[model samples]
Target: MIMKATGIVRRIDDLGRVVIPKEIRRTMRIREGDPLEIYTDREGEVILKKYSPIGELSEFANEYAESLQQATGHVVCISDKDNIIAVVGASKKEYMGKKIGKELEKIIEEKKTIMVDQNADGKIFNILEEQEGDSSYLSQVIAPIVSQGDTIGSVVLLSKESQVKMGDVEKKLAETAANFLGKQMEQ
Candidate 1:
């Protein structure tokens, strides 16, 4: 495991509450009212993990990605705010559990649906940082998943074949999947 020492320290208040530094919180994407899971190892090290509601639906996301891939004959991926949780396609191994790129994070924050093609710009934004500057995809559709007025995740449809064009149909499919996933979170 990789560990970094921030050299920052805090003390528990009278109520046993320790304030997380603002810089660390921003870097970890911890917002106000967000749930965090606290854990302590036998080694006496404490850990905090940002809880992801969409992560709890990993099974459902996988099933949905598979169905979407079959229906559209394209790559399908589902991601929570920070990482890709499910992927269905030949490239599954390349993306599963990968941290999402900043562009994808921005889309989730804006709660936007976007369709992009290789020819539109010099190169499409990387879906994951590991694939930065790689333009192997021919087309892509991205839709943000929002639940209870909060954007939580995204659904993506991607085509690697030049013959396959992503159009309104693919956009609608991605949007529908995103909407469905968002609704599932409410239950």
Candidate 2:
């Protein structure tokens, strides 16, 4: 006995956009151009079904972007070598405007990764040391966005000037942004 998987196939328009029937979409858990798997039976009957597979990581970068914004005491910037790609949080504009923020350049020229100052707490985020400012009391963190054996870009965060020491919470947030950005570039 062949159980029919019933669904309506609306025709494609001039722009090549097709509207699948609502019931079919709901039944198959389809959401707009979600690729369908099709086949034919012995009697040349068409079979349509949904193909479910996890997609690339960049597909959900927005979720991470939102989280980055929610994160406290930090200005996050996702950037490529040439320019800033995306900035999440209030201080994004200020961080992105600086051209010397490319951390990878220093990594290449110095042939070493600059270590974060252990006593450094909540102030500003910088990809490279441009000027010697007394923002040492400012909480800041930066992570190089590297994926698939290549250094794509970097992310940065400035800690809030609260009594809270720059602990695991701030470190985790910075790391998450960096990891998410690296995943985005990989895709």
Candidate 3:
């Protein structure tokens, strides 16, 4: 996530050592024990990046959602801070890569689980209904994936029937997913 307008250079010592500025490291969330990936592009320029397990998490979320499809009978979506990276159940192709608007972004901002039931009102409810196309789902549950105390993503489950009551179960499922992803991130 770090971008540079101009290059900053550093000299490598005899031991092949170069220090990344503390500010840059902080901005990139590059902790001391974190691994970095080094690679060369077609032009042979070296690129350094904080290693991420996004691919693995995406696959895991997809598989998890698929497994829960029968029991939940709802559309399950997994999203990073900005995008829908995985989904199961209903075919909302439109959901993929959709920039999660301010509505769900609040979950990450507040770092909490939120429910937008049919009778709910306010920004969250309005946004949920608008995003899902007019309250087609009877309820929505969104839980933030907290990694090292920061919300990195979210798990969203939408249920279809008013008669079905799964408030606690859906919340727990989201928490389960977040814990699962958090463990994966630690590796």
Candidate 4:
């Protein structure tokens, strides 16, 4: 679906900024501090799109899961309070958009990271033991995403093999992922 072009143009100032007209800004709900994403097509056309930082952070969580998986060769889960935002090294297809439930709610409330050594199912991580008759995960690390002094979400790293001993390094890395997400959400 294409939006009809209003086509109002303003010359870029010496400081390299072009003003978007008030009418367009008002229509787009572009507030003073709202971010705009600039993109260029192969045909050399420039497009300025409104940025949704929440979507960006969720995508960033995907990368965060992959990197953490490489480090520990484990399953990693990223969540945004009510939703399972991203997961790596596990069958996340069925888990995506699922509620985090009571366990994760506690994590957010306390704003603390937890290291689970064993579980028949990932109940403590707020993951289901079975989805379509398959196990979700057994053991995991649960970290709270704290932003601006409030717990907003969680990052959970699950063990793919045996139960993982969440050491200081692992704990720090898990916390770092949560903290990094917190910082991004702040921006």
Q: Across residues 1-187, which tens digit of lDDT does each residue of candidate 2 receive?
A: 5676555446869997666678766554455645567888899875665442212333344356556757563545554443444556644555443444434445423322232433554234345335345354355555665666555555555444545455566667766666666665566
Please provide, for model 1 over 1-187, each residue's C-alpha lDDT reduced to its tens digit, 9 standing for 90 to 100.
6679999999999998999999999888788988899988899988989888999999999999999999999989899998999999956678998889888889888988999888656356678856767667878899999999999999988788887788999999999999999999999
Query: Each model's RMSD to truth, in Å?
Result: 2.2, 15.5, 5.8, 9.3
Q: Give the C-alpha miss distance for residue 42 in model 3, angstroms.
A: 2.0
lDDT for each residue of candidate 3 in 19-122, tens digit (9 for 90 to 100): 88787886565667666789877877777875545545777878877776666787788777656778788665767656666667667669878877774552
Task: Point to the candidate with the largest lDDT.
Answer: 1
1 or 3, which is superior by lDDT? Answer: 1
Question: What lDDT does the true structure give each of the candidates?
Answer: 0.89, 0.51, 0.70, 0.72
TM-score for every candidate vs. truth? 0.88, 0.48, 0.66, 0.62
Which sections of candidate 2 miss by over 4 Å? Answer: 1-63, 91-93, 102-104, 107-125, 128-137
Q: At residue 23, what lDDT does model 3 achieve?
A: 79
> Model 3: which residue pairs collide?
none
In candidate 4, list every pair of residues with a backbone clash: none
Give the per-residue lDDT of model 4 (tens digit) for 1-187: 3657677768999999889899988656466766679988897878888664444587788988899989988778787655678888877776676765665667767987877665443343555323342244556678888877866678887764554555677788899998898898898
| Superposition error at 181 for model 2 (Å) | 2.4
Clashes of 3: 0
Q: Is candidate 1 or candidate 2 better by lDDT?
A: 1
Candidate 3 C-alpha error for residue 122, in Å: 7.1
Candidate 1: where is the Cα deviation over 4 Å?
1-6, 41-45, 120-123
